[model samples]
Target chain A: MLQFSFWDILSNLLIATQWTIVLSLIAFVCGGVVGLILLFMRVSGVTPLEWFTKGYIEFFQGTPLLMQLFLFFFGIALFGVEVSPWMAATLALTFWTSAFLTEIWRGCVDSIPKGQWEASSSLALTYIEQMRYVILPQASRIAVAPTVGFSVQVVKGTALASIIGFVELTKAGTMLNNATFRPFLVYSLVALIYFCLCYPLSWGAKKLEGRLNVAR
Target chain B: MTYKLQFAELLPYWDVLLQGLIFTIILTLVSTAAGIAVGTAGASLRTFGPKWAGAIVTTYVELIRNTPFIVQLFFIFFGLPAAGVMLSETTAAFLAMTINLGAYSTEIIRAGIQAVPKGHVDAGVSLAMTKWEVLRHIILNQAFRKIYPALSSQIIIVMLGSAVVSQISAQDLTYAANFVASRNFRNFEVYLLAALAYLLLAMLTRSLLRGLGRVIFKAK
Candidate 1:
């Protein structure tokens, strides 16, 4: 068995962190697109669309993300379609992120008073025009903090993808420990790296909330 | 595509599933109670304690909140053992979970505590109440009521996240799902069932917590 120096293990784990970063970016961006669409559908004032989106959110949020990843990875394979771990992880994280993002954005929209909607409608504005001109502009401001906060969650969510053989930070730590026989050192570094990735987002969310609260 | 879906293959392992579900419930309940107590103490200490104490609480909260739960679990279960602190898998799982939940609740409760006006707390102190008594009787009740919904959601979140404990062979719902799936080679069916079980568990836990909140806090 070849010995891996501490530097070797640390550098290797750092390299795998790149995949974690990439997966997080993909999931966040794609989920944002889908979440925005879901948010529009949810608030479209169409009862069917509202209920459908609500159920979609409920189904994803109410279940464990681990199980979701498992289902996507294993379920699709059962249908005789081979899915790469990257694909499965991306699919599962995207759906999971969208469900949460929609809910957060929906809350922001809901915080807008009913009068704004009525006033925009009275001006002979269509639903799209009202939201474009009056509602989402205000909502998006409040949405910023929560969206940043949830991005931290999305980053953490990508760690779960490691279970499905996506060689991200957490998985890299596990592999390093097995190779180096240094569980304490390896996992502590892993946790530290995660902390480094997450603390700025957490601090930024707090600052945004403080600034926005002052602005309001 | 007419792909056969055979949930029927996993039916015979209902007892294992039940055992796993019970462990999940027990884990959630134990950690929820302990975590709330820890969080309430941490919140009060941070809010009312001296500089050093507050710093300690802040450190604890930040450490747990910023890291993923799975890493924390692995650190405790696997890392601690390497450092000469052996723990059974279940004990490590429970400790990791309680610590995780406590940090989150500390933040939630702290926010609620801050929203309470200082004058009321001062008035309680001026009326010959000890600081502990003021916090316990006056601040705790009102703050809990204000943050109750957020707290309820967090509780369910912790429960759903307990599925990750299966990685350490905690014999929770996810572990049972994995066991039967491997045995029967019915991976999809077992996970689908397990996922459904978690959904029901999430809904049930939410309602149960909501009902408890109503009874304890009395309706606003």
Candidate 2:
């Protein structure tokens, strides 16, 4: 059996952490785009689109992300297209994150008071212009802290990708544990790394929230 | 390239799926009960206890909140034996779920506790109510009433996240899905049905909790 040093395990885990970061970034960015579209559909004043968006958010929110991943991984492959774990994880996480983001953004948009909507409309502004110039700008301000807070969830959510065999931080930790037979050390380090990745975001969200409250 | 969706193939495995669903519900019930207890105790201690006790709880809450649920489950299930703490798969799953919810609800409950107006506490004090009396009758009731919706949502979220327990080979619904999928070679159908089962379970749990909330706080 090959002898593995401490540095070997640490360095390998560090290397894999980059993929976690990359996946989280991609999911966050893509999810944000999808969420924006869903938000528009949800608030568009068109009943069918609004109903569709509501159902989309509810389905994604209600199901576990693991099942969503499994569905994409196997469902897509069943259609004669091979689906990698990476692709499946990305698709699932993106859709899951969008559901949450749209819901959060909707709450922010809804908080702008009906009077703001009425005032914007009474200015003879079109719906698009009202949203562009009046509603979204104000909602975005309140949306900042919660949005950052949710990114922590997105980062944590990527840990599930490891179960599907995406060799991210958690997967790398498990593989290393098999090699080194040090489950305690490997998993604790894996968790610590996640904590480091997530805590700053959580802290920043708190600070922004505090500042926002003070400003109000 | 041509694949027909055959959910009918899963009918033979209905009993196995039902067993798994029951186990998932049991896990949710146990964790939700214990987790809320842990949260209430932790919140009370953090808000009213000595400085060091509050700091200790704050650290625990932060550690658990920032880590992933699967990693925490892996740590308790796989890693703890190395440190001389052996836990069965079910026990570890339960512990992980409870601890995860405990951390989240401590924050939520703490917020609720803090939101209790100071004037109410002052009035309770002036009324000659003991500290415990005040906490029980005056403070906690209002806090629970205010934070009931958030606490219910957290419980549901933990229930959904419990699907990860199957990764540790716990006999949850997801594990049953994986078991049948591997045997039947119907991975997509198995998982889709399992997802639908979960969605139904979530809806059921939500309504159940909503009813419970109405009963508990009905006087208010």
Candidate 3:
């Protein structure tokens, strides 16, 4: 028989928390790249690209991420691609993050006055140059608060990775609970860690939103 | 390797799938209605109630918003029993989802309430209406209309999120997918079917909520 103490459990959970942070970063950074592409296509005034991105966003947004996780985790296996929980979790979360981020950023870009585009194009700027020099810098400022706010969702989203057997914070809590038979103590700490990670971003978003409103 | 989907195998489990879908619907409907009520009250409290009430509700909203729904569900289902509060999986799902929607909706509705022109409430008060009357007829009526799109989106989000209840065997649609996949090892087919169902459910829920909104708020 083996005995574990409180410090042992907390330390182990802390180590697993690192994976949660890493996974969230993976989703956030990769999702940002993909979301920007989608946003550009959406607002680029090209009909087919706009419709394609529009449908893509709806497909991802209109369903559960849990289902998408299961679909990819098992669907890839059908293609004989045995995915580790790490790969599956990252893939599902990245796509989910991209969908929401795309919508958020599209709104920001669209918020830029029509004159910004007209003024840039009147100078004979290419599409890319116009966006780079004129629109995106302005839009990114508006995107900052909401983008940070959405990162909290990605962090919380990583908790679902536990269901697929990813050794993240939530899974560590469940494992510790089984070992210690103290669900109340274990999960309270789990929730606390998430709160600590998330509350700051949410509060910051609120403060930034207020400031942005005042600027107008 | 030739891999083929066997939808035939899942055809036998339609009963289970239908049952789970109905349960998911019930869970969503019950929670959505109650959650909006809770959110409405919380928004009011945070906006107009005493300082203490506002503080309590602010804490509740932050707690729910900042954490994952599955963690909250697990905490209620597994953690509460240790403190002498045991809830069935269905009840736990309902409570967790209602709280989740409540927090999000509180923010949405609060935004709506804030957008109400101050003069509207002032006018209602000057008409000899009590505070409650002004809150209901003047403020809330307009606030709900203003926030209908946002509030409905949050509700559908919670409904899609309810899929996680299956992890605890609450017999939602995902649970049926799990059961069918495990039994037949047609994990791809089963989950694809479930995802399609969820997509349909989401579309149906969105339109249904929009219809309900029109009836309630007279949103054009």
Candidate 4:
């Protein structure tokens, strides 16, 4: 029997942690793009688009991420699609992140006064011009801190991918625990790794929020 | 071969799903009650207690907030046994959910408490009210009222997050979905039903919390 040393576990976990980071980055970037589109649909001043976006956000927000992951993983099989855990996790998390991002951004955009819109319209700016040149610049400024804050959630959300067998940090910990029969050390380290990954983002968000508040 | 979604195949397992749903609800209710109590105490301490105690609570809040709830559940369920603090799956899930919600609610309630004006506390003191009385009557009531919506949202989030407790075989709704799916091989349909059940539960829980808020805070 080959005895696994502590370094064996730690090194393996560190390698698995990279996958978590990569998944989080992909989800956050893709989700941000989709969320921006949803945000536009929400605030597009078209009733049908606004309603559709509202329903989309409500569905994703009201359900658990675990359920969403299961749906993507198993739901794809209904069409005989061979969905990999990585792809399913990414798809579920992207939609999940997008719903939240759109909601967060809608709040930021709404905080911009009606006067800004009217002012832009008065300047003969089309909707796209008004959004691109005037509104987004200001809204994105307010959006920065919370957006960074939400990235913590995206990072944490990647942990659910492990349930789908994505072999991320949490899954790697489970595998190591099974091998080592040391659930205590394994899970504590797992939680610690997640903390290391998330705390700096939380701190950065807090600091940015403070700076934004002071500037306001 | 094309697959058809046979949601009706889950009919025989409806009772299993319902039991799991009830367990999740029970878990949520008990955890919410205990969690809010812990959070209130935590927020109060962080706001008014001694510096060292506040520091401990801050560390706890940050630790729990920064980590995933599933890992916390795993630690309590699997890890604690190695250290001689053995807990059943349900007990561990309860503990983890309470701890997770407590950390979040502490932060939320602390914001509400900090938002309460200094003049309010001073006025209570000037009236010769005891410290306990001041906290109970003047500060907490207003703080709860102010943060009711946020508190409601957090509770719902916790309820949704509780779905993961099934991974430990805690018999949550997701567990029923997994069990039924495994038996029937209708993974998609079973999970679809489970997801819809969760969505309904969330909507119902939100309105229920809102109504309870109205009744509790209707006085002033």
TM-scores for candidates 1 onward, in order? 0.98, 0.98, 0.97, 0.99
Q: What lDDT score goes with residue B197 in model 1?
A: 90
Worst 10 residues of 3 chain A by lDDT: A1-10
Residues A97-164, candidate 4, lDDT per residue (tens digit)?
A: 99999999999999999999999999999988999999999999999999999999999999999999
> Judged by DockQ cut-offs, is candidate 1 incorrect, acceptable, medium or high?
high
* DockQ of each model vs. true complex: 0.80, 0.88, 0.83, 0.83
Better of 1 and 2 by DockQ: 2
For residues A64-106, what per-residue lDDT tens digits would candidate 3 score against the true structure? 8999898879877878887999999999999999999999999
Off by over 4 Å in 1: none
| Candidate 1 residue-wise lDDT, A1-216, digit = tens | 798888998899999999999999999999999999999999998999999999989989999999999999997887788899999999999999999999999999999999999999999999999989999999999999999999999998888888889999999998898888899999999999999999999999999999998998
Each candidate's interface RMSD, rounded to one decimal?
1.0, 0.9, 1.0, 1.2
- In model 4, which runs have C-alpha deviations exceeding 4 angstroms? none
lDDT of 1 by residue, B1-220 (tens): 4578887888799999999999999999999999999999999999988989999999999988888898999999989989999999899889988999999999999999999998999999899999788988889878998999999999999999999999989989999999998899888889989999999989888888888887997755
Badly placed stretches (over 4 Å) of model 3 are none
Tens digits of per-residue lDDT for model 4, B1-220: 4776787899999999999999999999999999999999999999999999999999999999999888999999989999999898899999999999999999999999999999999999999999999999999989999999999999999999999999999999999889999999999888888889989999999999889988998886
Candidate 3 lDDT over B50-133, as tens digits, reads: 999999999999999999999999999999999999999989999999999999988899999999999999999899999999
The ten-residue window of minimal lDDT in model 3 chain B covers: B211-220
Docking class of 3: high
Worst 10 residues of 4 chain B by lDDT: B1-10
